[model samples]
Each structure stands twice: as structure tokens, then as C-alpha cells.
Target chain A: MQSIDHHFLDDYACRNALRGIDTRIKLILGLGAILIAISADTPYAPLFIAIILSIVTVFCAEIPARLYLTLLLIPASFALMSVIVILFLTGGGVPILTIPLPWLTFTATDVAALNAFLILSRAIGGTCGLLFIALTTPMIELFSILRSLRLPDEFIDLAMLLYRSIFVIIGEAVAIYNAQVMRNGYSSFRKGIIAISMLSSSLFIRAWDRGEELMTAMDLRCYDGKFEILEPKASLTIYHILPVFLFLSLAGILAFLPLPFPPL
Target chain B: MHIMEGFLPSPWWQIWVVLSAPFVIMGFYALRRMVRENREALPLLAVAGAFVFVLSSLKLPSVTGSCSHPTGTGLGSVLFGPFIASVLALIVLVYQALFLAHGGISTLGANIFSMGIAGPVVAYAIFIAGKKVGINEIVTIFFAAACANIVTYVVTSFQLALAFPAEVGGFMASFMTFGAIFAITQIPLAIIEGLVIALVFKYIVQLKPEILIRIGVITQERAERLREGWA
Candidate 1:
């Protein structure tokens, strides 16, 4: 709701390169990697991918690695929580690694170790890869890619509307939430609950009204189902294709390569 | 619970990614139309998404502070239809994961499909059903929120179960078990969510009567109540 954050969401960096790359290709490459990373047996692969992606994001996409790393805590904490449980629940196989923690025991089998390692790495790696792609790419272009890929007409149309309306509702939510923060001092535990509960109630109304206002406006516009105007897609360029291909190929080769034991 | 990275089997998330292909296309097409029709509304959607995002930052009364983020699908579905809300939920889950590392990018498809799509749709469907049953607005909202919460947890549990294997009931058992553990928090949270939805609806209905008429989002009971207030 702050003016600065609102401005940040609307930003589309790497505009020139972004425009040049076919939206469809990026979707395929980006989404495909997501699939690959999620399915892999070990997190090492995604970690490998993440390393490569961090490089690409910095060098090719020109996004700051620090900015990206800062966002990582959210996923890292989640992975840690799950992995810790898995390490405990999944123990009793061959003990690959053993660690003693304060009031917590961590003894695991090879499978669990592999599972823990893979899940952690893949989740973290796959996520970073996505962030790299999403930040570098624009939402509209991503939408166009959806169109080119033959998404359902109804589905795409709905996204456009929701995407448009979210900000309006957020303004209201922020206003209401901020008001709660002011009243309740959103820091403490007890007050936070009341604030959150109130925010929930308030956000629903605002989002609804916002949606209705949008619908009315559209109704006035001689609303047909068609989205008449669109950002034109750039023609295919070998320059673009070559990079995506190289990236995928490199990831694949890394997957196949045999790394030495204690893969440092 | 937002399943973190390196947790669920990649095969499951991969299958979900495959399923998302069609939705991604549809989502983009929707984006274009939405841009043409409803550009002004996006900041609100972003804000709502951010609001939920910020809620995670707040750390409410859950035993696991970080694990229990609020589900906006019911609110989103009630306000913006599920189709749009589903995408918003998907975006929230993805960005939360990517930006905050809250959830995994791989599981995002499944996460969105379940919590995002299933929860909102279930809530909307139940709300509509409650209307037919002549339920009051407050109760209707509560019922819908409860159902959405339960459905979201149930679906996520099943998805998680598929990642593991059980001898007999398999995912069905996992679904119920996870539901049991989390239901305590979810129960009150769902109620809170419902009350929130109801109040917001009440406020907005007061502000813009035209919107309810156009989107047909409001209930007859609530509309009648608003009319009584005016009288």
C-alpha cells in the first residue's frame, strides 16, 4: 500500500531484452525447469541449477544476486522445517550423517539423507530459478506466452481481470490493515491476532467492491469477452533461441555428469 | 501447511507442472483480456495479495508461526470469481515461495490447484448453496470459509500423501490425519476468515451498491440487510 511498493510491482526491467525474447519460449524454458527441478531425486541438481541461474540472473538478466538472496529466507526456513522433520521421521536406514542437537536428535538413513538433501536443494533451487525468471520477465509477456501456448480463452481472460483488480483491492486492504496496525500495534502477539482477523474481514469487502466497480466500468465499455488490445509479441530471433537452448543443454549435461564423492 | 522446497517428491511437483501448462496459457489469455477490461483493479489484487503476504510477516497465534499463513482464496473467490482468485493465489504461492521462500516453486502448481482453485471454488459453491438454503449473510460467509479451509487442508494433505505411501488408505488417511492436526488452528482461523469476509462485504456493499448489482457477488440476504440499514 505504500507508494514505493506499488511502484515496484509495476516495474518491468530488462525491457529491451525482454521484448526481444519470445514470451512463449521463456515460459517453456522457465516452467520446464520448474518441472525438472521438482521431480529430481536430489536437491543437488536444483542447487546446481540455482548456481547457474544465480549467475544468469546476475550476468544475463542483470538482477542483483543480493536482492535475490534476501528473498530466499522464506523458502529456506520452510525447507529447514520440513527437512528437520524428515531427518527425524525418516531415520533408521543406514546412517549417512549423524548430528547431535540440543534436545533434538538427528540420525538418518542413506535414503533419508538423500531425500533430505534432494528435497532441500530442489525446493530451494527450483524456487530461485523461478524468481530469476519472473523478476526478469514481465507479467504481460508471460500472459502473451500463455496465449501463444493455447491456454483456454476463459482462463486467460479471468487472469487479466484478477491481475488488474488485485492492486485496487490491495490499496483498500493496505489502508484497512494499516489502520489496524495503528490501533493494535501489529508487533505484539495478542494485538497481531486481532489485527489479522480484522484485516481478513475488511479485505473481503474491499476486494468484492473493487471487482464490482471493475465489472461496471467494463459493462460501460461495451464489454465483450474479447481483449482487443495486446502488447505485440516480437518475432522469433535465433539470438534468443540460442541462449535458451544452451541453458537447457547445459543443465542437462550437468545432470548427467558424474561428480566426485563429497561433491564440493 | 506451505510445503517447503526439498520436501515433496519432485515427480509429484513435475506432474503438477505438466498440468499447469494449460492453465498457464489460459491465465495469460485472461491477463490480456483483464488488461483491456480491468486494468485499474490489479493494484487492489496486488494489495490483497500483499496483505496476505504481510500477514505472514505479522506472525499470529499459531503454534508454528510461519507455517500457518492465511488463506485468501475464500475472500478472493467471494470478491473476484475463483478463476481470477485462483491465479492470484497461484501467484501469491509462487512469489511467496520465490520471494520469501515460503513455499516451493515446484509444488506451486499443486498448491495453487488445491488451495487456490479448490478452496475458492468450494467456498463460492458453498456460499451459493447457502443462498439457496436461505442462510443469513454472516452464517453463509462462515460456512463458506470453514469449507474452504477444510478443503484446502484436505487437498494439500492428499497431495502430500501422494508424495509418501501408506499401506491401506494411503492419501485418504494422510488427508484426514493432517486435517486433524491442523484443524484446531484452522477451525478458529476459518471462523475469523468468515467474519472478515462478512464485514468487508458489508462495508463494500455500503460504499458501492452498483458493484453488487453488476458483479452479482452479493447475497440477497446481505443486500436486503443493507436496504434495511438505509431505511
Candidate 2:
């Protein structure tokens, strides 16, 4: 929809302040926050996690606040829609709000309200955690970490190849799509289907050609089964590790705390 | 339809990861064997994975005025075997989660299970069955792709229902509610996906029948007949 700005996330990741930190630490912190937020029974901890992670991603990571919020809006909107459905359709305890319609009645019970809040907060927390990682660590850095984690070499190698070729394939696809649009190939639904199928088939052919070229190129280089991936040189500093531990423990403790006020 | 980031609470997500592990492992073994037998399969699989990613990025014009993208797993499954398709789907999905932020790492397992494993396996099965039953190739491809999309959404709905069962009528009612809502948009999208993939198959049949035969999708005799018919 946005003309496929391929470098949007990677641009921030390359430029972020936390880019200097060890990627493994960043991943652990971000993923741990998400796990804790989701597993928590109450909504308070997740909501708190969302706010804290957003602040870190914006202020500390030095990501542009406007761009970060724009990305956050995508998931937030989806969560809001699901929350609305959850609020009205589910029923338990006393009803908090009711609307009488001609064909049917809608009710939002207290239990449903709380459940909706939990879902909304979990979504927010999870999205923030995910964004924090995406904004800080580029995928190139993650490959070595995957290697260190003892993941199979073949799996990692394939991931690397997939990563490298995805951009080229996507560029070819975008070029074809633009050409199709110029010709009014998508003027009607039927035409759109035809245009897309042509696009997909042609892209597949292009990918096949590229794959053959890659294999030939690699073979020319001696056809070794190993791909040499350099590990990032960032050391594990206590300054980064201390803050992550503190923040996660703080969130973990917060999960067990009672809500400051009871919902009506 | 990805289950969104952090949508499935605790045990459900973990369970999906466990359920999906075996298939992914099998995919790895298949991939390893392919490479050991012929190193060319490695780059082909990677590029195919990238193709699936780009396909997901394309917007489909739907009758409901809501645009959705083709999953492309159906095409991948039909072109490559289901096992390799799972590996390709896993790669595409991880990239989608990390780079695009369309899905989440926490829920990656669940998404992979539905889109990567379940959808592709079903699509491959249908494709094979249709061939066995001597059905028309276009009709078979259409149903293979369409049913793949439908089964993906059904599995997603089942996962969500298990996580958030209804207080009034429990898991069954919650599943029906989710299935109904997903059906509203997904049914039309599925039909479109089916048509698009079928058309892609037709183009491949016209241009690269040899590749189809190589992949065991079409027999040599069938390709010869189709080429004669076209000429």
C-alpha cells in the first residue's frame, strides 16, 4: 500500500543507539518482556510493559517518535477491533452496559470488560516488545546469533540465502506490478486476477533464473558448503545487561501486584 | 490471517510450537537430502521462499472492498513438495515477523503451524488426490489453493478458541463465532487465491512444463499432450 518501502525498519535498526549493544542481549530482553507480558494473568503488567518498552524504543534507541508511533498504530488498530468484539459478545458476571437493538440485544458484562482489557494490554505489550527488537537489531546481526545458538548450519545458510534474494525478487515483482498498473491490467477484478497470476508466474521464473545464477556464481568460487558469517564484535556489557534485568524483574514483580482499583 | 502478535496466551502458543516442531524438523531433513543429492535445490528453495514473501506483499482486489494478499503456500506446496514448502514458509514467516512486523516471534510457532505446515500439507494432499481421481488440472489446482487458505483460517480459529473460550457457550461457540467472522472476509479472499494460483499453474504449464515434470507435478506424457494442444 505504501509502495513497499523495503528499508523502513532496517534503516532504523542500522541507525539506532542500541545497535551498538550485543544483539543477543537485546533479543533476550525483548523476547523475555513479551513472554512475561503474555503469561501474566492481569492487564496491569502488560500495560506497564508497553509504556516502558515504548519509551526505551523511542527515547533511548533514538528512533523517530512519529515513525515509531505510526508503526505501532497498525497493530493497535487491529487489537482495538478484536477487543470491541470481545467486549460485547462474551458474557459473565453482572452486565455493565446493554444496548437494545431491533433484532438483538448487546451486553458488555464485567468479566467481558476485564477480558477485553487483558487482550488489549497483551497485544500492546507484545507489539511494543516486537517493535523494540525490530528497531534495534538488523537481521544481518541475528544470523550469527542463530549460529551461536547451535541452530543447524544448513538452516542458517538457507536463511541467509533467502534474506539476500528476497530484496532482488521483491524489486522485480514491484517493477512488474508497476508495469501492469501502467497498462490498466488491474482495471477490473478479473483483470486484476490475471495480472497478479502473470506477475507471480513471471516472478517465479525470475527467481528460478536468479537461483541458477547464484549457484553458478558460488560454484565458480569453489562450491563450498559453508557460508562464512562474521559474528558482531559487540561485547556483553553490564550497563546493558543490568538495565534489562532490572526492567524485566520490575515487570515480573508488577505482574503479581493487584490492580490499583477494581473495575465496575 | 496471522493470529497477530501476543494474541495467544501462554500454554497455547507453546503447544503450537511443540506441535509444529516435528514438521519443521522433517522439512530440514528433506532439504538436507535435496542438497546432498543435488546442491541446486538449496538456492532454488531459498529463491522460492523469497518468491513466496514477495507474493504475500502483493495486494489482491477483493469483492468486499477489503484488500488481502495471497498466502502462496498453495503454489509452493504444489510446486515443491509439502515438506520443503514448510521450510520455505518458515523462512518467509520469520522474515515477515522480524523485518515487516506483520507477525510476532512469540506467536511465530502458531502461525507456522497453520500457514506453513497445515495449509501446505492439505494443499499437497488435495493436489495428489485430484490427480489420482483423474480430475481436471485447473479444477484441482483451484481447490488445492482454495482449501489451503480455508484450512489455514480454520486452524487459526481453532487456536484462538482454545485460548479464549466463551463464558456462555465455551470453546465450540467461540470457535463458531471466530469461524463466522473470518469466513466473511476470508471466503472471498480464498476464492481469489484459488483463481490466482490456478492461473499461475496454467502459465507454468504453458511455459515450463519440463520443470513441472521434474518436480513430479505433471507426467511427461501429460506435458507432451498439453504442449500439443497449445500448439
Candidate 3:
């Protein structure tokens, strides 16, 4: 099937929605998914959810399944949380096997085999919910929700600046790092220091000037004390309600069901 | 050291996390003011945030394939202060949760408290102490980051203990033990974090004289002299 990552979706997906359901509707559904995925006792629900996610990614995101899988799935290797813990802890439900000589210890002979499957589904389930929200929502609209929610101005401001800066500052650091590689690479720890020095010096000077600029911009916008979200479109309707209920129902049903496969 | 789903029941983490939502809202309001007040600082904050984000995403080898990323908040804390750091981290955590699923939302309050509040407040206090004590600058930065790392984990452990009480001992004992598990990974991470902080600070001191003034590491008078001396 298709890869689950939303990051590699086609430009068409980013530019236009397949269904283009109301943001609130998608948001509600996605949030409901998060709760359901978290509560599910059995792993099958998550796997099913993952499969659904793949279908959505393929049709809605307009990305080729293979490329998406290669780019996103490969990097997803970072999801393993406790392969060692399960190996030594009876894999929770798996049978135990012990080793002796070096030190008397315990392990599940099938722990590796089981955990790989378990963790993958868990990560995929949780990940799909998040991707749905992120890919569908634009940054400004996302902030708009926080504003409508009556969030504090201070936190919003921090996000505003931090978000604006992520791309800028990263660009500078990359340039510095590129220069460093040209000279010595990170061949030695000492060389790494030189690269850091270059990065840090620019980091400070840039932040100071930008801080003053940001304050002025806030004053001009009549920012007041509270962070006011410019009123939303007020166009929400049945579109929002349906997806939310559908996703919630799907996840809720999964939470109560037992896994057909073994726990592993 | 991020806590994931199923580690603790949903009810506990959810209630605490939801309770803190207002605090986050208030924090947002405050940061908006800072932004309005310090528009010039936008580009700089971006660079700082990006520097940290990129630097943080780099994995450090410790126990085999398990890699711990730096929060990189030592300097962010030292310069921005904990309140602002709280705002910054809230954004970062939210993005990470929604995008990467590296941490949990039910633990957002807990995350902010540990990484944002604990690290910055502790790091700032120590840094100020070192400066007042007239300790070496590089050492001060390194020491502050090192202390921050330890304190952050200790606080995070307490957060975990609150959620998951072990059967072996009472809640408090279990809390301490839970904190200890992270302390194991954090110790080496702290040392490396310290080294990185020291190196970055040292490099800044050498390459960009203007930053010293902006960050308050040097007074206006000192900055003038440095410029005059160079001239």
C-alpha cells in the first residue's frame, strides 16, 4: 500500500484538498482519532487505522505510494521505543528464554519479532492522526484556532517568532556547517567547535535586532493584552460534524475489540 | 526521555494537561506583547530557534542505537528567561507532537514544566550565579547547561511518578526511582550538552563582537571599547 507520511505529499495536495472538508470538521475528526488510538487495548485497531491512513495518503495526498513509502518509512525507523525492555521483560505477553554465563539474565526469544510488529502499528496509528491534522491545516489557520480558543498572547507571540525564525536560522546554520565541511568536515571534535562558534556568533546578533523589530510590529497591530484570533470564517457546518463522528466511531469501536493476531 | 501512550493511563495525563491550558493561553498573550515590543528581535529569535532545532535533531550515540537529542534550551533559557522559554517550548512541543509524535500532548503541561520551566529557571539562576561569582565564562555556560539537564530530568521524573505510581513503594519513592531512570541517560547527555554549549559560546565570543552586547554578556562601555580597540 501507500506510505503513511504526509510530508512528501504532492504539491496539488498542499495546494488543494481532495474533499476540502471544512477545517473544523477535519480537526474534530483528527483529534477524536488521537483519543481513540490512545485508548485502544488491542493493536488491530491501530493497524486498521494505519491502512485507512495509507488509502487517504494515496488518494487525497496525490503522492505516489512507492516514493512516499521510501522517503517516510525509512526515516520512521526512529520509532522503536523499548526493544530491549521487551526482550528482557517477558515481552510482556511473549514466552521467556534465558541466557547464562556472562550474567544470569532473561529475554523473550520472540520479543524482537513481536515488538517490531507492535511498535510499528502503534507508531503508525498515532502518526496518522497527527499527519491528518498537520497536512490539512495551514500554519496561520492553526494559530487562528489557538487564538479563537482564547490562548494567551505571550505564548502566541513566542510561537509567532519561533515559527518565523525556524527557516531563517536553520538556513544560516546550514551555511555555516557547509563552510565547515569545506574546510575540515567534522573529522575531529575540535573542528566541530569551530563550526559551532560560527553558528553562535551570528545567532546572537540576529536575534537582538529581530527582537526590537517584532515588538514594533505588535504595537502597530493593536495587539492589546490578549491574543485575539481574527474571527474565523464562521462557515462550519455538517461537513465538520460528519468526519468527526465517523473517525470517533471507527476509533471507539477499535478500542474495545480484541486483537485477532497475538499481542506481539 | 519522552513519555508515550500506554505508559500511563489517559485520565491522569489528560486532566493535568488540560488544567494547564489556561496557563498556556496566558503565556501566549505575554509572548505576543514581547513580539510587539521587540519586532527587531524577530530575525534573531528565528536564528536562535532554528540553530537549536537543527542542532537538536542531530542524534548523539550513547547506548547502542538509542540516541538522545539536546533540548538546546540552556542558551535559549539563559537569554530568553523561563517565561519566554515556556512560550517557545510550547510551540516547539506542539509542533513536535503534531508532526513527529516525539512526545505526548496529555503531557504537554508536564513537558513545559520540565524542559521549559525547570531547565531555564535552573540554568538562568546558575549562570547568573557564575557571572556574579566571577567564574570563567565558558565554564559558567557549560556548568549552567549541565545543571539544567540534570534538573530537567529530575523534574520530568517527578512528572512521570505522578502519572504512574509503582507498586513496589509508595508514590514518592516510586517517583524518585522513575526520575532516576532518566537521570541515567541524562548524565552523559548533560556532559555532552555542556561541551556543546561551551564551544558555541566560545565561538560566538570570538566571531561576533556585536552579540556580546546584544546578549548582555558585555556592557555598552565594553562593547565600545572592543569596537574602538579593533578600529
* Ordering by TM-score: 2, 3, 1
Q: Judged by lDDT against the true structure, how good is candidate 3?
A: 0.60
**Which regions of candidate 1 fall more than 4 Å away from where they truly are?**
A1-25, A42-44, A96-107, A183-223, A229-240, A256-264, B1-10, B14-64, B76-105, B121-135, B166-191, B202-231
Q: What is each candidate's DockQ, to 2 decimals? A: 0.26, 0.68, 0.32
Q: Give the TM-score of candidate 1.
A: 0.74
Q: For this target, which candidate reaches the highest lDDT against the unseen true structure?
A: 2
Worst 10 residues of 2 chain A by lDDT: A1-10
**TM-score pick, better of 1 and 3:** 3
Q: Is candidate 1 or candidate 2 better by lDDT?
A: 2
True contacts kept of 3: 0.30
What would the DockQ be for model 1?
Answer: 0.26
- Deviation (Å) of B12 in candidate 2: 0.9
Task: For residues B99-152, write the lDDT of model 2, one tens digit per residue.
Answer: 777778888899999899999999999999999998878789999999999999
lDDT of each: 0.61, 0.84, 0.60
* Model 2 agreement with the true structure over A150-183: per-residue lDDT tens digits: 8777788899999988989988878888898899
Q: Which one is best on DockQ?
A: 2
lDDT at A119 for candidate 1?
65
